[model samples]
Target chain A: MSEPRFSVGQRVQIADRTPPVHHRVPSYAKGHVGVVERVCGMHANPELCIRGDGKPFQRIYRVRIPQTDLWAPYEGTDGDKLEIEIFEHWLELAQ
Target chain B: MTGHDDHDHGRTFQPDHPEPTSDAALVGLALRELLIEGGHYTAEEELAVIAEMQGASPENGGKIVARAWTDPEYKKRLLINGKDSIKELGFDLEPYEFTVMENTDQVHNVIVCTLCSCYPRALLGMSPAWYKSRNYRSRVVREPRAVLSEFGVDLSDDVDVRVHDSTAELRYMVLPQRPAGTDNWSEDDLAALITRDSLIGTQRDLSTK
Candidate 1:
């Protein structure tokens, strides 16, 4: 498997795609920008273009973002943040 | 802890359904028996764990909440990496490891595992039946604040609701902020204020109110 392109503290954005039927990615986070918090090693990639191939690929990263970035309209006293695990394929370097 | 019964085990066979246990039930029964036979735990210890598993008592979560309430530095550590921080409190994360997230005024946190029930079993014990149900997994992400309200957890409209979807590998636990009325309270007193429902985002920390 290839090493993940992104590193901790690197800014990245979620790829644009129709959500998978059974996905670990949350629906609210699609197309959002966040910073990589941790590289959670690699695992068998679940999003296979064709099913039953049994070819495993992909690394997962833990990403963090201020709550305001995800929810623009959010207004709260304490600045909150969220951390999510995103597969390699779902991320692209933010320009 | 005070209002609700800590633990209760009472069941009588109902006349409507009189049948032998199914394969699934047998498998579950055998799994428990094997655990004891393997010397993984004493029968009494197994029962205690099982009771917590059944949601009779949320021992681990209560401890986490207590530490967060009393210790500022520990709370920071918990927010960063819940699994290791909880171990510092003398709780084992062996059976099930967990990822802890915090929710503040600006952000609200909720957890769901879409494919299967992935939960912080080490800290929160076994996931509740409701957490495993499809209804919760499907609806929480779509309408988090509304769903929380149904459970009597009504957040202010301004609070951002962030729902976490756990996959097969990782599980999530939400650490709510400490309540206000707990000034000068001991760790034990603060722990008593945490409930199983609170950890799951179904209820708030009663100490705050």
Candidate 2:
């Protein structure tokens, strides 16, 4: 069981890689940088559990991504935000 | 297998007859059969379980919201741990995390499960049909303003929108800003304003007007 690498308020980028397997990270959020909203506790690795292996538990974080950064020609206010839960492996600390 | 044929094949089709069972429904039926056959749970037990789940409704959530509006201490606790706070009111979201999003003057919160229909059933009862639709799951995360406006909740530009995607174990409920002209209203009256859609953040500005 690995401790959480990212803390709340830290900037992290979603892993751009899209493997041909089941995952929780939404496609629109892939490769985008977002701030960690909250550090959710560990959860069973869904990607692994689907294939019958649930040994490794993962630390999940709620990442807050601005809608303007997500969609080009954004029509909503700059304050508009989209927050989603991302597993540890799908996120990397971004500059 | 009745196709809309131009030829008069049937005298009259039953308007009440729905289409064949969907693939997901078939799979669910199969799983239920297997479980019953294996003596895991009796058919009556399954019915009882479903009956309890269907019995849940938004009124349970309204009680909590009304309490939070009237009690500052309970509100603080509810904001910190929604699942536990609700247990005080005889409702719980165990085996899952329940987070309450407070709607302040500038921040408006909405809940959606983009990957799937992961709703706080313990609070909002069963998830509405639209909440589980692909159209909402995809569009709300993108054009939230448009989607919100369609629901008759038009927010000002200063009010930031936060769409909480319940993709994981956690479930969320929005604590709407208490309506005006209700200062003297009892908790029962206040609870009446906490509609299912308002709790989900699709409706804003709860009012007696």
Candidate 3:
């Protein structure tokens, strides 16, 4: 497969998936906007379907978002940040 | 329920018995011995890892802390995509996954896999035995301040306490800020400053002695 396209500091949102099972992506992060913090070297995509249709894809990006943004009504530390890794397929540029 | 009780009551227990090892247990023991023999880790390290396996959450937290201290950008990334972010640290999210919550001056974050010991094993090595116990999981969220106090983590009432339920694929690791004593310390020195308790939000960074 072709290398996935993403860059550091780019704004992106996690792609929403249906009937989420045990997944590495956080539920609160689904549909939430975040900034690309780092481009982690490639690795096999862990998310798999029973049919095995989605082959292992690479290009994972470390994304960061302010905790206040993730938790609405968050009245705590302002600059606190939460980071997570996202596969190329699970992200799209945020408008 | 009555029929099952009757059957159990009628069953006699045998005192003398040979313990049969489960396939899983045998395999695990063999793997552990092999790892030790190969010098992948020392007996002490193996013991530590095994003790951690008794409780899955703490080990996972250790892994995350190790990675965060080692890599700068990865630390930043962890604050973004906690679950997915760990993969960048060279950990595989397998039967379980994790979510990361950061604690700061104004806010405090704690995680509990209430139903079970849902933990970030990839980043942390294993969870503490207490973490897997039902008593801890059940009571911590209800009385966070009290529970934290038990671990000597006394937060002011002004600090916002956030409890994360690590039920789904997400587990959590607390990324404590580097301590101030070792300002010019190298990565190794910085790493030495981090203890398992600090990563789990139980204790603060070690002071320069």
Q: What are the candidates' individual DockQ scores?
A: 0.16, 0.76, 0.08
Q: Can you list the residue pairs that collide in candidate 1?
A: B179-B208
Question: lDDT per residue, candidate 2, B46-107, as tens digits?
Answer: 66666777888888889999999999999999998787888899987877878899999999
DockQ of candidate 2 (2 decimals): 0.76
**Sort by lDDT, top down from the best:** 2, 1, 3
The parts of candidate 3 lying over 4 Å away from their true place are: A1-95, B1-73, B95-97
Please report, in order, the local distance difference test score of every candidate based on alpha carbons. 0.69, 0.85, 0.62
- Checking candidate 2 for backbone clashes, the offending pairs are none
Q: What TM-score goes with each of the models? A: 0.65, 0.89, 0.50
Which digits, one per residue and each the tens of the lDDT, describe model 2 over residues A1-95? 57789999999999988777777888888999999998877877777886776558788899999999999987789999999888898889997
List ranges where model 1 is wrong by over 4 Å. Answer: A1-4, A8-38, A41-58, A63-83, B1-57, B94-97, B207-209
Two-way DockQ contest, 2 vs 3, winner: 2
* lDDT per residue as tens, model 1, B1-209: 12224432111112244443788866765775566558786556755665555553466788887788678898888777665787887775553345676767666777877657777765676678989988997666545566788888877867766666665356667777778767888888777778777777777546544
Give the alpha carbon lDDT tens digit for every residue of B89-165 in model 3. Answer: 45666534444555667777666666567665545556678888877876665455677788887777567666655
Best by lDDT: 2
Docking outcome class, model 3:
incorrect
DockQ winner among the candidates?
Answer: 2
TM-score between candidate 1 and the true structure? 0.65
